[model samples]
Target chain A: MPEELPPLGDKVYLDSAAAVADIPDGAVILLGGFGGVGVPENLLAAMADHPARELTIVTNHAGFGERGLAVLFRQGKVRKLICTYAFHKSAFVFREIYMAGKIELEQIPQGTMAERIRAAGAGIPAFYTPTGVGTQAAEGKESRGFGGREALLEHALPGDIAIIKAHKADRLGNLVYRGTAANFNPVMAAAAPLTIAEVEAVVEPGEIAPEAVHTPSIYVNRVVLGENLELRSEA
Target chain B: MNSDPKLEAAALTPGDIARRIAREIPPGAAVNLGIGVPTRVANHVEPGRGVMFMAENGILGAGPRPAPGEEDWDLINASREPVTAVPGASLFGHADSFAMIRGGHVDIAVLGALQVSARGDLANWTVPGAGKGGIGGAMDLATGARQVFATMTHLMKDGGLKLLEECSYPLTASGVVGKLFTDIAFIEFTEEGPLLREVAAGLTAEDIQRVSEPRLLVAGTIGTLTREPEAAEPGA
Candidate 1:
């Protein structure tokens, strides 16, 4: 919303993300996905062309071998990662983060993480829950009595641009998400500095229903056609 | 109403039941101890049994307490308390860790409970407006572990029962728990029903019968709750 970068016609909007080749290294990025599903492979591949090193990432899954947002980690672009489950990529992500002491990683309890993100999106500011009151996750965190047990105040996540993939989007930017891909994209779109979505198809504004829209156009800034439906369905 | 036999003991303290459940575990078993009373079992396994403790956040073979000057800053269990790993223990992530539990690789799972219903319905997981459900892995373990046991105080306040003909608490697993080890008695669950093994010392069967919420099926014979070993006195 800056005067120089009014939401529309902003120079930052490279006709397609390819217009600018140099993104500042070590930038914080939030990706949406679980495993390989909903991954923005084209945008990720585009980002990979440049050596974006030491980047901090927020995501749900580490992806499977070069498929999930983890391709950035494999490319050695991520310096830190915040996630719930990394079982699929633990051999590299866990060992390197916890064992080898290479990158800093924070693993959130799954259900708690889901609620925390939802809380942030809902503008609750701060709230307490008794989920991780006594476990290791409780270390270095303040806990207060709630009801009869204890709850901890886990801070809401603040991100740089949040990048997501959705099934389709209208020119106005209202989006539709399909299948397993809905994991973290919807919540994260509103929680970041900027949300860029890559869609399988783009149609006119009225094509999508007002209620069927998972993310309204206000939350989405830019949309790029990444792949055709016929080609995407094959995968 | 039915000729119940579990009310076989005299009187039992909370700590007595905790210690009894602790002793029941054999050494070298892969164990997942649930929160609350069962967590205390970490202190009671037999010596030199090579017990491997597992925490859901991906630690295996965790030892009770870390040795002096041996604390590694990075090494900790799900509780985040300083801990030592048993010999040959290694690290794994959530998927592998859960696969270990659900894959029937774990030998025993000890859980805390509000109630073990007559039909063996476990109601532990609590929902916000619904009640309590830490659910963690309790649901998976109930049906997965080779042995499942419950450790808790027998009766709730207000003269109510934690063991009922049917559970009032939300059930995580149905008919999967093997034993109910409580402050007052020992019960081995079966298709025939909960057959009582031992009762608290000093309390008569009549006293227990009056307190039991459901009609507990009686065992053919009764045994006395075992006393702590002689060496246990000095430590106390």
Candidate 2:
């Protein structure tokens, strides 16, 4: 007789707080967003109240106004930031903390940062590109010649956890994003060991067409219903 | 401001520079407009030209800024300003968006520059004394685009020449700029040197040479640069 298999449990959680409850201190978090879009605002709010400290966050921008990542920075929960753009006019919180030398920052080119995270998800160790050759961005990095041009070696960037926002998700954790809001969520979803997604709505598994899914359920570990935050374009 | 008649007449407005650059773009070319003055190029491109605007933050075929109360937070440009998507537009993740840029699929990149060398070296990201500024996609766009153009003022506020023999600011990319459009002149970088192509209506070649640090080579008759009148606002 064949061995009996255990039943599979649904990935849905009641709220954002419960989804992010297990995040420990000193965790490397890959945050999915580009400016104002694709940010997991509800999950970030929950993290602000959580006791986790000393987090190293990887994202596109540091923070916009006084919400989202800015709130976490104001609370002293973030220890380091790996991002492309760090100092916008409204990102006063990150700028103040960084100027005081209270936090660490590693600035990467926008394209290179995206590729590094994508490489981690694709299981590639490292790759070479000609984006930052002969500039300060190439300092302390290995170089080689290819096709009569020089390229720099960039390594894959992995994270301990990935927190992302999606437009919709199935109970099986399949995700779909709306418009430009898909910016960094798909890449971050694949680069982390534990991926928690905050979605506006949850549906049955068959509700989402397989071909229309932006992120497959295999990469997502959990999904929770998030409050619909007001959408503004200033950030 | 104490300004000479010749100096005042030679100056072209920011709109002139943007419209001049827009006329140079061929039909059906994919263009990436950098922040600042270059962003205005999109407003001048005639409709139905099939020109596509690529925003580095994962948008292709980006349209004009939306009217008030019609802005969608999910739809924005690289500058994080709310914009509309043109017909047949497509959206993707950051990885694929940058792949389109770094892979050299973009035909033209129009960027604003702080300083540009005669040899086409570009330096615009950060100044020497200024604190760390974001690189964004400038380096990738500079190195990957088939042709790079820079739009900037001809002189600094202190009356210093911005077209230099060598850039004082940090280099965004070396020998990437092919064409330059300034408030006073339009020039092209050739293998020999920079060739003066056009000048403002009241300025002569000698007048341009006075402000430019590097020697400008003039061949044939120089054309006068002029801006077309503004088009009527849509839905007005």
Among these predictions, the greatest DockQ belongs to 2
TM-score of each: 0.49, 0.94
Winning model by lDDT: 2
Q: What is the C-alpha local distance difference test score of each model?
A: 0.62, 0.87
| lDDT per residue as tens, model 1, A94-117 | 444445556677765544554455
**Regions of candidate 1 where Cα sits further than 4 Å from its true position:** A1-235, B1-11, B67-73, B127-133, B226-236
How many clashing pairs per prediction, in order? Answer: 15, 0
Worst 10 residues of 2 chain A by lDDT: A1-10
Instruction: Evaluate residue A170 in candidate 2 and report its C-alpha lDDT on the 0 to 100 scale.
Output: 90
Two-chain DockQ for each candidate model: 0.03, 0.69
Tens-place lDDT digits, model 1, residues B4-111? 244433435545666777677787788888766676677666658777777654567876655667654334554334566666877543344555665578888888
